[model samples]
Target: MNAPARIADFVINSNADDLAQQITLLAGQINAATHRLLKLIAEFDTCKGWSGGGTVRTCAHWLNWQCGIALGAAREKVRVAHRLEELPLIDAAFEKGEISYSKVRAMTRVATAENEDYLLMIARHGTASHMEKLVGKFDRVQRQRTDRQHDKEQENARKLVYYQNDDGMWVIHAKLPPEAGEQVIKALEAVVAPIQEERQRELQESCSTDAHGDVSAETFSATVEHEKRESGNHFQELLEHTRADALVKITEHFLATSAGGTSLQALKGAERCQIMLHVDIDTLQRNGSTHAPNPHCREFEHQQWLSPDTARRLSCDASLVTLCRYHHRLLHQGSFSIEAVRDEGHDSPALRFISAAGATIETSFFPQFPGVSAETSPLALQRLAPDVDATTSCPYWTGEHMDYGMAVDGLLRRTQ
Candidate 1:
């Protein structure tokens, strides 16, 4: 919201009554609306907005301005609406407004199209808890589909084979399957796009001394990719969007750096600068030098293990892999990897700390106070950890030390 808030601490401190009331109100609202939509759409064979014109071409037009979504997004919504009417159970739930409209839309995609039976069972006799279990099952199935598609592309990718016509038109051929033909094209383009971007960056840099020349993937697709898939080309279009999302992510990494950078469209078969990471010391070791104080990725590991927002930010493609790597390396040794995964008691996100070595002990960086600050007030790290506490000397910290490190001016820093 509003271009993601610059990283901030969580400052919520609501009472139990407030939390319960908020949840109940939301639940009631969703149930009421979900029921109304299902009842309205189920009884009618065709929506007033839609008729048998069935242009297949007609769907894309609706997606843009009117629907406020992409062409693919609009068609998928229509497809789900159509499928909902086909089933009595989901349609009935829709009529009851037991779930939100958006939930129904997501369920349509995630719920296996091939397995109508699973949806039917839930529709007939299932609670919200049951639906959640079903959603997990759907997610697992979708993950499997994604995996198979990846492997198929890898094995099916081909080597180049060319044919020269008498008129001097040379046609290049590749061995990849129909599903991976786009991927093949993508691989070849990756090599070409960066070269062109470099030329542009150099040209722009030469034009002005003050200007930070940006040579991103936008120019590559514009100058190099002359042909793009049309509306009906669902699978291919989705694949390309996925690729674009990835490229955008790479470009965002340089935002943290002073140097203006480029995002080259350098995607090959199953190669998209992707990394599978977890909360562990091993991850930090790979990026950081051995002599570095904290060679482990304890901070990243803890964020992944403890906080959802930090984990999401770290996992995003938009966050450059390079920056994340650098961030990992900067953290102190043994200090980074999160070991206490199973959270035992209620925890606050005031000040999170990472130990350089020991696992059992975690120092609470945020000091607690009766008045502290208003729930909405900005926190001052200095107040949490004062420079010289009542005890004149700095506390000697150890693995067994219960006291978190001292507070520096408006910040939490190591004691000593």
Candidate 2:
């Protein structure tokens, strides 16, 4: 029989079980062929042929337009294709049809020389869904380790930069992590709040008076035009100027208190600028409990309430102190003192707070992370990565309709 006649006969005679086995076998063969396609893609990418001398944006975009693949999927394919070059065991398994493209895709996301073998083992033993979930969990663990390391370096990275511009104006730039940045914002807002209220009150009084209603339309229009000329923007320009003025006031107040006042008076000014938060002693001793009867924090000055989670975040800094009401009042009254004590085996001096009556107020607040102690080093994250497996050394893909770049506008191109 001819080849077509024999293939048709075989298909006509096959039972359900036989067809299932054949389908599975063909699927494996397809996966194996996909590995070869990805190998070519990786070679092309490494040669920077994807650039096509600015005609093509990226390898992924070329794949999308020429191969009819979705852009997001094409990007993933490109990423996987490049990554598989570094993972040999996965690559080999994919080439041999021992694993499907789905499995290879999941393994490639996190596989490295250290964990490739373990990942391959999972791919061989598990379904695509199982492998995908495992990969997601592994990535989360890796991210958490990175975040811990970042947290350790954050303090050193904090900086404030200032310079005079060519326009004879000063420019200021600051980089602060969320908690520290929030403190600066709160201070500026506290100083600006009274000014905002005063402006609103004046506007209200003006509107209530007969004189405000007597203003001609031409006069109102001239006032708006004058404001636009001065501020150089629309309505919000005035608010921006107000904030700029507030920032200057804060800087001046800080400098004045720093250079001219007694240390106690300076401390008072500093404390006045802070956002007053009230937290229960027991709740703070706990890990910011959500089940507490009052899981809310009250803003002492603004009469606003904050969730326990927010309170926990605000209190996470090393400089945060747990002051009793009596001590807080004494602090404002200049009836308390702070002295730096150099303890044994400590690099930095510990601050000790004392009342005028000579009693010690040894309250302190420190950030708490679950399962992590205050003494835990950033290196602790190294222990969280998955253990390396010894079974595999490699990485895979599925693609079709491959094409090389055609001569376009008299230029010989290679990536399409």
**Among these predicted structures, which one has the highest lDDT?**
2
lDDT of 1 by residue, 80-108 (tens): 66767655565555544344455556556
lDDT, model 1:
0.43
The TM-scores, one per candidate, come to 0.27, 0.36
lDDT of 2 by residue, 187-281 (tens): 88888888877875554455443755555556555665675677676547667777788998987687557854546345454445555466654
Index of the highest-TM-score prediction: 2
- Name the regions of candidate 1 deviating beyond 4 angstroms: 1-23, 38-73, 110-416
Query: Model 2, 127: alpha-carbon shift in Å?
Result: 0.7
The RMSD of every model to the true structure, in order and in angstroms, is 30.9, 25.7
TM-score, model 2 to reference: 0.36
